[model samples]
Target chain A: MSAITFIDYAGVAVFAATGALAASRKQLDIVGFIFLAAVTGIGGGTFRDLILGVPVFWVANRDYVLICTVVALVVFFGAHRVESRYKLLLWLDAIGLAVFAVIGAAKGMAITGSPAVSIIMGMLTACFGGILRDLLAGEPSVLLRPEIYVTAAIIGAGIYTGCELLHLPGPVSYLSGVFAAFAVRGGA
Target chain B: MSAITFIDYAGVAVFAATGALAASRKQLDIVGFIFLAAVTGIGGGTFRDLILGVPVFWVANRDYVLICTVVALVVFFGAHRVESRYKLLLWLDAIGLAVFAVIGAAKGMAITGSPAVSIIMGMLTACFGGILRDLLAGEPSVLLRPEIYVTAAIIGAGIYTGCELLHLPGPVSYLSGVFAAFAVRGGA
Candidate 1:
């Protein structure tokens, strides 16, 4: 439980940094950076919770919003020192994507117990945040790219669901999902 | 009560048609059309509900989904007969914007009882769906356009919130909002 919680916060921070990086590219101010970061960090989870008819995580626990804001603040001040913001954004996105895919799938499985819906939820969780960030920042959406992004999320989520079906231990299943997603995304 | 409900459904239908028109411009198949239509029709309300911590409108009542699907099907077969799908889309979007702005504000007022938040909610409900449509269809977002689009929503939502503060009758407040929004957008 502690491990999952740590990874979840870490994923949000990573995603939030990507959003702040996007804002810096757009030459937006501090408020814009924070707004983009918050949306990019939690947009996918918000959508998933809405569809699942559950309380939104950020609204229920303001800590998520705080994390995003803190990350945005850090990135806003420190971004000038980072070389190749785009490359950093991609690597951070890959890490966040792997974590979020597994987390989202686990949440969906716990709620709905439907493997198909859980997989879709996992994909949405991993992908929608970046999609929202790009839309708001007016960047070309990653979805429009021919890269193997969404496929990595699917592989991660699929492996997790497969492990659950095979009655694997929790940590083993979770690690398998994360590594699968990271391998595919990082390889690409 | 019935009037608002009727207008709500009509707004959804109009927004769905605009999404279908976007799909036609992209030369997408029926599935794509339906997907875009459903998202555009319900996207704003979904965001509003999620933020307000309420059950999503379409998820609670399947009629909204049905309306979008039906509108998509109609546009799929009948689009070629229209002289200017783009013009029609603009007009329909304008109407939907008007209706949704007022309706969204009303819902927000009912839920939160805060005029400022209600006005913001109104703007979100009016504008977010089209933003989602444009984003998904890869159209330059209406938000990026230097038109009076978002301003119209603000005007409508603000007026509605002001009317509530003044303790005006429901119909008067509602019509004032809708007409103000339409006048701005249509004139633009």
Candidate 2:
């Protein structure tokens, strides 16, 4: 549970950067940047929560919004530097993808009361926000292209589900899921 | 119910024009125009159905997609003419808004078993497709502005709910709701 919380927090921050970058590409002002960041950060979780009729995760946890805001600020200040070293942000995005995928999968299981829905929910949580960001930025979402994105989420979710079948500790399953997602997302 | 059906069909057509306009604004390719039109036309209903656990309406009834596609083609060909008389599109939008509000409210009343949620659902169906289009097109969503939109939906929904309580015919309630919404939106 502790590991999940920590990783989820980190994941939100990483995803927030990717979203800000999308807005930056369009040269949006601060308000637009924040809006894009908020949408990107919360998009997947909001969709998942709404689908499950659960209270929205960010609304339940203001820290998530704060994280997004902070990340956007960092991106705003560091846009040129970040763009120069895009790899740093890309790696962070991979980590975010993996961690978020696990959180989404686990939450999906807890909320939707079905394993299949949980897995799909996990994938949606990691992928859809990025997809939405791209779509809104007037670019095709990477998910729609043949890419490692949705596949990474599915693999991560599969690992977590398998760990559950083996009666592993929740922390172990969560880490494994994150690791699985990152492994694929890192182009490995 | 029958009245709601007709209103819904009209709403779809109006939304198709709005989507077509978005494509024109972007100078999109034909495929892009169709994609944008399809997304804008059905996006809100898709969100509603996904959350409500209902079958996606257009997927179930291909006619919905057909309607939007045919309308989009018409708009694509007629965009210059439509732009020449922009007020016509705005009026069409108002009519679409009213019809969608009622259809959404009616569906919510039948599906969720809650009135407050139904009112919100009504506004979302009426307004959010346009919001999605704006967001996707990098324009400001009308929903975020100080408009009389949600207020109109609330008033119209109250009429529909009142009729539901008195066991009035659905068509009578639908027309009343539509009329109330149209007057408010147009007057505003």
Top candidate, metric DockQ: 1
DockQ of 1: 0.12
Tens digits of per-residue lDDT for model 2, B126-187: 77687787787776555444256556666677677667767898889888888998899889
Distance (Å) between predicted and true CA of B83, model 1? 23
Candidate 2 clash pair list? none
**Residue A11 alpha-carbon offset, candidate 2, angstroms:** 1.4
TM-score of chain B of each: 0.98, 0.91
TM-score of every candidate relative to the true structure: 0.62, 0.58
List-wise, what DockQ does each model earn? 0.12, 0.07
For all candidates in order, the CA lDDT equals 0.89, 0.76
lDDT of 2 by residue, A1-188 (tens): 47668788888888888888776776765645665676678788878787777766764356887888888888888887654544665676688788878888899887665778878888988887888677665666777664888899999987887787678999899989988899999974
TM-score for candidate 1, please give it.
0.62
